[model samples]
Target: VESATRTAIEAIRTGIGTKPETEIADATEAEAPVREVISLLGIIDGAESDILVPDADDKCPGGYFHCNTTAQCVPQRANCDGSVDCDDASDEVNCVNEVDAKYWDHLYRKQPFGRHDNLRIGECLWPNENFSCPCRGDEILCRFQQLTDIPERLPQHDLATLDLTGNNFETIHETFFSELPDVDSLVLKFCSIREIASHAFDRLADNPLRTLYMDDNKLPHLPEHFFPEGNQLSILILARNHLHHLKRSDFLNLQKLQELDLRGNRIGNFEAEVFARLPNLEVLYLNENHLKRLDPDRFPRTLLNLHTLSLAYNQIEDIAANTFPFPRLRYLFLAGNRLSHIRDETFCNLSNLQGLHLNENRIEGFDLEAFACLKNLSSLLLTGNRFQTLDSRVLKNLTSLDYIYFSWFHLCSAAMNVRVCDPHGDGISSKLHLLDNQILRGS
Candidate 1:
């Protein structure tokens, strides 16, 4: 810059002896090129320039160049027709957006560049050339943002859905979303969240916040009274976390909760009366855990609305009778456990049960009248067990059963001497009994 200024000064001095007006115009035009060179150099080097316009000309001083020459302070929106805004038209510079364009190219592999730009999914929409949508807070998506901290300046008023998935947030500190009071559907899944403070969701009290998804995080436990009074969150997904146990007060204020998913965790125990407050819960997923027993106190009479309960892939060896108090249950999954027997009254209350899964267990005894109350039962899976008998009377009253799986139904009925059914006659029953012709296919 010093060398260029000296060279321009030398040229001005050479024209000092010319006529006054002509000499001044030539020097003025020569100085214009020098200043333009410096401005262009700042753009090329990616540095903040000290260039200034008259305060009167810059209506929005130190603010974004929002449409045309009007300098209004708003959220940054750099996409443009890319021609001119200022007298020198500096706003038109750097229109390529190469840095962000290349970032998407690297993350979305096996796909062409710019494949994910401005895509819309359901109510969520990725930002396009127009920074924010016309429907501002109705659906705001900041997914894959790589943000490490929560921004205190988030939009608060009348916000309904906020999708912050695939970020870098490790913990949810207190008052993190206090500014966003009206946000209803808060989705923070696929983040690195290890801890969540007691009042992390207090801002959602003013609205009918219905869904809270914190799946695929590292959360080990939730604080007592996680939500305040009158909070109406219905869906809570905590799958694939590090949770070991659930305490009673962990869900104290959630009375209207309908669906609770705790699958793929290390959960070993549920405290007595842990779900006493969840009177309206419907679908409960306790699958893929380490629970050996389910306490009856957890399913108080308050759970009259409970319908589906999944306890598959656990280590439960015995179930205390009357453990499942949800009389309206339609689906009961006890498959992939260590159960060796089904008590005579184990399923007496499940009159509405449609699908009963006891497959892949150690159960050998089958009481025919045990499932007499389940007149709506349609599917019963008992594959991969140690049942050595083929008594047709045991399954006689299953009027609603269509697809029933056993060790090998047709083979066991035709010949208990079949190697796969009894392996040897040592376990008893080389006798064969047949009551039907069709074999259950692909059981």
Candidate 2:
């Protein structure tokens, strides 16, 4: 009886021999029935058992056994493996596992090149092990991949640059940059990368990483530790990233961050401590945001080394008293905003501010003390706003003010006072239109 059962088992096993072309199809066909039996025994190893079991059963008759070994069978869930498998159920798909393993191994192998190689270049549309190239001494360009995840390995090209622009990459993993150890410049423009996971650039410690282009990514917010640990980062471009607010902790570690491009975002407000952390920060681009107010104390007290600040195209209604904390801020742009009023102490601490742009705003009134602290202000712009009349006090304290734009706005009062008494001044800019509880001319 045992011999007959063994022979039957061997025959069945031989009939179901492995075939690369037919393995997937046969597995699909056999999975349904075996899966049902596996479920009955509450086993998750049906795929493994089917692959690992030999073709012989020596102690059974009629090619069948009613033994009670069902209690020992263990079922494996998907993505639940604690080891390198991570997903035991995925092991059933032979082709998928092979592709994943090859790709992972290729990435792991190239990780040391980032440190040992003199130069590195990357250009990839699809992430696969078969597409890897040896390190060349030229530039690499990889744009428009529509990638939703970071690639396993950046290409290994010595003395080469990387261009990964116009993709759908949402998050960046730390290990993704293990292969580009010697990369000098990294361009990531127009990539729809929304979230940057923690330590995404930790592997770039060995590289100089001079310039990082991250424009038009539609990033709403950033994690605190987005940048790498070291301070080798010089130029960082974060333009068109829909960023609304920035906390102090967001830039705590970026001491070497020099040029920051934050153009075309939604920054309404900012904390004072946020700017104090960037001791080496020089140029800042903050144009095209939704800012409603400007509080000088909201900026850091340590931003005395700042050179340029662009605050154009915002909804800034009021410039609060004792604002403008940066004493050395050279270039300032406040264009294209809904700025209705400029209080007496608006530009208080900006002693060395050189270029001032106040164009494209709704300025109904401006107090003389608004520019009291701006001793070195060279140029001023007041164009494209709702300014009807020119208050003499607006430019009273601007002894060094050069350029002023009074093109837009409905001018009502020719002779208007630009100075107020209280630190918390009354809403004087909005009240300029109310004559008898009615709008004056173009109210």
Instruction: Kindly provide the TM-score of model 2 when superposed on the true structure, using C-alpha atoms.
Output: 0.57
Query: Residue-wise lDDT of candidate 1 within 1-443, one digit each (tens)?
Result: 64444444445546543345565565446555444533532322222222333356554332233334444322122222333434545445544433223223322223111233354443333334243322232566667778776544445455566667788888788867655546667778889898888877776666678988888899899875478877879988888899998988888778889988888899998765788778889988888899997655546677788887888888999887677877898788888999988766677678887778887999888665656677777666677888767565555556565445566433234221111222211221211111011121111
- For each candidate in the order shown, give its overall lDDT on alpha carbons: 0.62, 0.56
Deviating ranges (above 4 Å) for candidate 2:
1-138, 145-160, 391-396, 408-443
Clashes of each: 0, 22
Candidate 1 ranges with C-alpha deviation above 4 Å: 1-138, 151-160, 411-443
TM-score for candidate 1, residues paired by index:
0.61
Model 2: lDDT of residue 411: 25
Error of 2 at 263 (Å): 2.5
Please provide, for model 2 over 335-422, each residue's C-alpha lDDT reduced to its tens digit, 9 standing for 90 to 100: 6777877777677677887666676676777776667877666555565656566656556566554333345322211211111101
Q: What are the models' TM-scores?
A: 0.61, 0.57
Best candidate, lDDT: 1
Worst lDDT run of 10 residues, candidate 2, spans 417-426
